[model samples]
Target: MRGYAIRKAMQPHRLTLKVWAVAGSFFGSLCFVLFQGGKLALMLFVIVSILSIYLLLGKWSGIRKTAGSRQLMNAEHETTIEAGSSLNVSMHLQIPGIWPIPYVFVKERLFHKNNTEYTYEVTLVPDWKRRGIFEYKTHPLRRGFYTFGKTECVTEDIFGLFEHTGYIELPQQVAVLPQIVPIREWHQFHQMMKGTNHHSTTTRAVRETTQINGVREYIYGDRLSRIHWNATAKTGTWKSKEFERESLPKTFVVLDRHSQGYTEDEQFELAVSVCASLFHYGASRSFALGLVSGGAASQFFEPKHGQQHLKAVTQHLIGVEADGTYPLRRILKEYVQNVAPGSFVTVISPEHGESMLAVLHWLKQLQLNPCHIFVSADPQRKEHWLKSLKSAGFVGYAVSSLAELPVMLGGRS
Candidate 1:
């Protein structure tokens, strides 16, 4: 039994050498023997070695009993939490052992799920009993999925000679959801424009321009593709195809997540806030809503109405960053091609670049009503962009902050 205990206790350990203790003890014992003769030296050596060995054996037994026990955790934990919230995890350990660990210390290590960031390590002094239910709390700052990985319950023998670490697997996941903001502007704008509620059929099933109902005389802004070339040539008059809606219409919020799109982090965060607000508003009304964001990987959520779909989208948005491998125009054009015409496309961008210009031009060609919103840090620049957009026959809104969004879109700014 002693041999087995020693082997188990000797598995793996960290040494915290107490230099002062060693040096003092060694010299004191040496001097005692030098002054008091061979008897004192012989007695001191035997007593010290015996006591150290006994302590090692005791530690071996304690750890072997604790680590070798199979059933440790008794309950599961919450797998999700909102950002800026604390998560409390409760765990019960039933290790059949002595009540008190006289001269040993227990330790626990906290780490991120990915193990990329080292959180902290806590040491528990030898207590009356360390075996019981434990409550751990974590405050993760970033909005993303995180988890508690491994808990190392370590114990060091008396005199800090050796420290044995026994790992207890703690597999718990927590998904930190993104911050949601309420959208006061969208509904307020709806009440003013078209003079109807946003939830009404007019806004819900808005007419689509892709479904052609008939052909009519071409207008000045009609694209060549929309012109009936053969008919126009035969009649010597400009004839254009007219398109209408066949299915349910929805609102699609496209966020420009390109690195150069936003002026800074604040602008990008505001864009995300706007998306989240729209998501909440649209989901609550059961309105089919879609989102298109440009980043390292394009995220395109098809228009759908449900709580489940909203959850999935929120999870994606929580980790979404303003880092795009492709131009915002590419992502916009891709989703726009499949979107229903007459559907509201709310384009949120801070920078007015050529890519954005191309998307607007494409939307115009398709006869899709695109509402371009330019979030500006400079008032002068915002007016200039608005003028350029209006001159090109597009509806645009310029706002210094998100608070002014509703008023500007309502034509009441």
Candidate 2:
């Protein structure tokens, strides 16, 4: 591959001396014979002979000089940049003296992972002694991995009669991450939960395990094991431990990875932006945030807080793709079980399928606070689904567009 690219870059001008020389010689020879040996024929013969000799020797030497020096010419470039960013490039030629190339062509081929291509070309000053610096910037049309293949340098003879091109084996890459937008906070996510205070066992990790702050009437989902036998026997009523709110509460943002979900690029991207924004807000609020998604390439990040944690989540979100084979409900159900119960749960999905409905029902049964966000949900298609969720007392938000996400989120605050 390297050799092929280099060879292509080193190709000469489209027009060659041999072709023009041959035509000139042929016409000269034919005219000489047709003229029947006159002075004009002699003059034509002399001119043709001189032209042929110069073409053969002079042009050959020029080609050789370029071809030989090409080995010493190196091209390099900085490859990575954001989707709409710039690149810096440099090329060095170590052939001694400032050789004048009236027109030196440098072209680069950029290929996206989607098999689409972008070609960039530029002309350099012929008077270069050692190095040339070029700044190349472009706005990529789409997001994905981009490859910068070999740089092709086309150096032609002084007369511009022929071109000698040499390819520089410079292979680089640039990754354009997906465009992320602010999602703010899920409207009324925390307020809708039964309890306004976010509590966890760690709040009093230093306190005695036997020290139960108080007993709350046991809900159906409360751990059967948590039933305080002493209290139950004394009061003739089921009771459970209720810990105080922790210093830092945790929220699990589960991105739906169901294979059948988010089939559309636009909808999926919007969903991703929502997740990313929620993570951003979590970091700002100093809330320990965790990410959960399931598929063949499932990614699970335990609830964490701080700048480093935020960076980790952002990096993961940048590369996350909705190609999971599992359903959102399955992914959420599995992930939620591992996280601390009685904590906050947020599900972001573009699909409003039965799987989500089942997950919601299960979450309520477990007494886990649940918030479902519909990404780019169409009113006509998801109106019934939204109505049903509301009727069940589960307040859900259906964001028809990205612009509405912030408005709805801010309103809830």
Candidate 3:
């Protein structure tokens, strides 16, 4: 809360200046009376001196409100910053009046957890524009959120006889991002990848491969092994099967939401960390990766590749809002038509049973091999949950602790 105390035209020293001038005049008048010959001349001089003082006082009092009422202009809050990076604050102040205030002083109060205030002052020079912008950029030495307290502006009277302090309630907040620790080698991810490969291998030969998903007239170079005998016999023409080249797989990552899965803040950080790491991994491996958040609106990013795509995915993850009640199945169902068959998909969540089963069902429909990474705040439940994922056609890896993420993704990407 901010309070403003305006001492408008309240001159505490007006009497002092007036008293000094009166005393001078009285003494001069008395001296002229004693001198006799020059009495009238000295009296005239005293009268002139009194008029000069009155004019001086009028000149001093002439300062009207030079600027408008001073108030906080705007405040900005940001979530991400380097650990030691600066939080730049640009304050807008409205001062009224034509009074020529020589200078305006702005004091920024930064409040700490201990209830201590760190003050920094800057002098704003007056411009013809009347409005002043005081800008300051200071590095946050410590991590966590810091609140910018009220700002005080002090201005002095034209005669410098008194000082006025006005407070502006410009509260601001900023969060410093933790330093990024990259994953070194993707060994753990490689292990999970191996499991997916193993699961996919068994089902590979069960489905017949075809190009353009249909039979075509056999060409001269067509291999005898590819002849679609049933189709050829029905049409009375030689038809051969054509299979698509073994292209890179498209991977869609679905993040699960559950109210009691973890604390709200923890889920947010974990989601960002995992998304960034996975996007980096997929980009390096030339896999088309998509990200979907489970919620009412069903936010989805279609599978894409390259640096721009990775950035887009990571940005979405950073901005992802958690709504724990939304079912993971709902999002998968919305994208079912868009998801290609046989594409490798991965789902991450702390949820088990229904949530895990939803991902498996989506995979079944797409004919995709899927991996599940269950993130739990509880350490003891990690392995048990991972094992449960394996039973559900997903090779699950659990994140028991937050710090283990860098190692889990294998080192720097």
The candidate that wins on TM-score is 2
User: Once model 1 is optimally superposed onto the true structure by TM-score, how far is the C-alpha of residue 202 displaced, in angstroms?
Assistant: 9.3
Per-residue lDDT tens digits for candidate 3, residues 146-207, read 56776777876445544556767746554444324455355544444454446654422223
Clashes of 2: 7
The alpha-carbon lDDT assigned to residue 160 of candidate 2 equals 59
What candidate 3 gets wrong by more than 4 Å, as runs, is 1-180, 187-246, 257-262, 361-366, 391-393, 400-402, 410-413
Cα TM-score per model: 0.65, 0.65, 0.51
Which lDDT tens digits does candidate 2 get at residues 1-413? 99998777655433444566667776767677577788777777777676555444533333223311111112223333433344444444332234444565778777876577888887765444434444454543444566777677676655556555566665666655545555534447544332435244322233224545566566454556667788888999887664433444467888886657765777777777678778776665446788886767888898987889887776676666678886666676577766556667788887665767788878877777777888765677667767877887775777766666777676641
Ranking by lDDT: 1, 2, 3
User: What is the C-alpha lDDT profile of model 1 across 1-413, one tens digit per residue?
Assistant: 99999877755431334434545566677677778778768689667656555554654545545542222122223455555566655554434455234333333444443455545444444345555545556554455656555665656555556555566665655566655655433533343334322445463224445666565666455567788888788899888775654445567889888887666766776677667767887665446778888788888888887889898788788778788867766787677886655667788888685656778888767756677878777888888888888788777777666567556644666
Clashes of 3: 21
For residue 127, model 3's alpha carbon misses the true position, in angstroms, by 15
Q: What is the lDDT of residue 287 in candidate 1?
A: 60
Clashing pairs in 1: 208-245, 208-341, 211-244
Superposed Cα deviation of residue 158, candidate 2 (Å): 7.9
Error of 2 at 139 (Å): 3.6
Q: Which one wins by TM-score: 1 or 2?
A: 2
